[model samples]
Target: MERELSRTLPHEPIRWLKEAGFGRVRLPREKGGDGASLPQLFELLAELAEADSNLPQALRAHFAFVEDRLNAPDGPERDRWFERFLDGELVGSGWTEIGGVKLGQVNTRVTPQADGWSLNGEKFYSTGSLFADWIDVYAERSDSGGPVIALVNVAQPGVERDDDWDGFGQRTTGSAPRVLLMRGSSRRTSMTLPSASATKLRSISMCCWRRWRGSAARCCETSARA
Candidate 1:
């Protein structure tokens, strides 16, 4: 999938993603996935990134898609709303904020309402948001406590998109700014997941070893043994 995506992405990976079941690997079995372990998925992501950074992103989109559904309460609501993601119908990420708001610096706020919740804030660098069915947004509490994630329906009424991702490279990502209004009934809850590690080491290791070593490998091996 990585090789294929590396060559075709910025153009055709989405179609392949839908067809190959790469989009459903993390989803529940009932929701059309193999339910693979995280280690396996992580290794796959490394390989995918080695092929093309974009591939890992599609993989992350798939991860977030299933994760959001699995995190939700199981019932007609969960089944009805999150089924498309398991089916590879949507793709996107929920990180990043406008105006250089770093992680733990969330400005988005989620307020409790009668039925569900209401969310209001602007988010940026949301990769693949243009093609996303929903976005996993994080908001800070003015009172106190940890950050909370809100599963926002971007297709719903009040959400606005400001796609301005015009990078020199990675031109196909379509990442941009988004403004979400709090008119819809949304699920406001915290997600239980670990933070990802630095990609630099993996990036460096792969870049170093990917090419054949006529003399470098021998010298390193001899030095280690000595």
Candidate 2:
């Protein structure tokens, strides 16, 4: 138990979370999820982090996507995504980009293609992406120049991920990896999700709570094991 944090990713634990439907904890019970509230989700995350901080970190993006979908207007389109979550598919983050003025403001971009929009960008510190079925990429449309979230399938040839972290601690928080999406077709979420909604703000708060609580939880766990 005292060994250095495994250089290997916690594939088995992540698999357990998926099979147990932890990823869909935010969905309604009728929608085949636990239907947990945001506060409840944050509570569970703190507990999960207590056991293994990396677990909550790995799931950050997945939960965020769940919340996003929960906020979307209900329809068959939304139901399909709910079913995907019920089926244990996970979403990963692709929000952060390196360099400056790669575009007007955002580095990532989605350009129109004959088939659909192609997401082209390089993201750093792409936490949890390696374990994801899809990536929730933040990109701007080239034509309209508006921001959108591009839900990109991981199986496509255009997505690339590698663990390139050289930091001093937490070798495998499922973080600090790089993801490159090169002209990958995506399912776009328009910017209509209200940013000011007090309910939706819980998602952002949950992210903050995970970061602040995860380390202390891990420390306590290590001490208990000692």
Candidate 3:
């Protein structure tokens, strides 16, 4: 794992975690998950971070997605998602835009089309995206200008990710600049996430502080087998 980290992202370890059913730790066993408590999950993350801190960061969105779905209303929509989690699929993030875009502004927009929807824009600091099967996008409705969350499949032709996150220490975090073009018609309600970027500031900062101090590994896991 260390050797691979020198050349590229730790795909092996990430894959290993998925096959081990780590992403479903927060879920109930009845739902085909590990049914781990929140504290236990954090402890596991801390251990994982000690081995390779970049890993937990790469899986932040995946765990967050699981948590979000757990609170969703019980129904077919939620049940199908639980199945995906058990299948080891992962979700990444796409809520931020860099540059002078300002604090309260969003550049990504989702417009309605004859077939479905059109998602267009770029996102920076897209951590965990390189290995993501799906991207949780934050966008605005062109028609009503209301905020909405989008869950876009990464394999779609319209989606693109670049290996450009060269941050100081979190370089190999599977993070990259993501571009969503929606060349043709995309499905209705593509990868949508909350526009509550501001609300997460404090929490993100806390995690960063913990990471810097070599403790408090709070999220995600990996794929490669060692």
Candidate 4:
């Protein structure tokens, strides 16, 4: 599959996967997913990685976002995001920064205006942003300088996806840096997910991390047995 993917550069594997309902593998059965358990999801991911490593890496953020939404308290926000996922809209992330040692701390600024807010900053290692319908950017609130995650529409103004990834390999994963300049009214652009007191968020992160490590270990054990 990796060789096939390499031969088919610029192919739409994400779309193919989504069309096949791979995106909803972990979503609850009530929410139109297969209700796959964490171990099941990770095992599927590992298998996909064994076939084509870039496929799983490119879709990592999407899976993480799905997990976060699944773990979120039942509310309007959760419903809205889940509905979007069910609607076949892909969500990508742009959180890391250039020359930044700290993880999850972004230099992107989300400033408020009378109409809405403006997002201004550049992000590096923005994996899977280009192919996604929505981009979740980690930014600092201009008013309080607090960290926040803003969901921005990819088609909105001030968003640019550059194809300047100079990496020697995995070039088709769309992991290049990108820039976003979003300006809209509060109603349009205020979909911020607060992380200040994200106990649930932290729990979800740790859970996924453990599942990932366990999946790798299980794969190794299986290989040894084989």
lDDT per residue (tens digit) for residues 1-226 in model 2: 2223557777888999999998988889887788898778878987886677678878877877777778777898689889999999998887778665455367787787776667788886677887898887777778887767777777877778777767665556566646545555644432332344523554565666657576666877899999
Residue-level lDDT of model 4, residues 1-226, one tens digit each, is 5444453433477888878888778888998888999778777878877766777767777877787778768998888887777777887777777665575566778887866787877776877776777787778888898878788778767677776766555766667754334444343554555654453664576577667867687978999999
Error of 4 at 110 (Å): 0.6
**Candidate 3 lDDT, tens digit per residue, 1-226?**
5543574788888999989988888889898787897668777887887788788889887777777777666898789889888888898888787667988798788888887878877887777888888888777887888887778888877787877655655767877654333344576345443535533643564465466445332222222221
> What residue pairs are clashing in model 4?
115-185, 116-185, 116-186, 158-181
Candidate closer to the true structure by TM-score (higher is better), 2 or 4: 2
Span of 10 residues, lowest total lDDT, candidate 4: 178-187
lDDT-wise, the better of 3 and 4 is 3
Estimate, for each residue in 125-158, the C-alpha lDDT of model 1 and write its tens digit: 6767665666767565434545665666677666
lDDT: the better of candidates 1 and 2: 2
**Which segments of model 3 are wrong by more than 4 Å?**
1-7, 177-183, 188-226
Cand. 1 TM to true fold: 0.59
lDDT of 1 at 38: 54
Off by over 4 Å in 1: 1-12, 28-31, 39-52, 64-82, 100-103, 141-146, 177-226
Task: Please give each candidate's TM-score.
Answer: 0.59, 0.81, 0.82, 0.81
Top TM-score: which candidate number?
Answer: 3
Sequence-dependent TM-score of model 3: 0.82
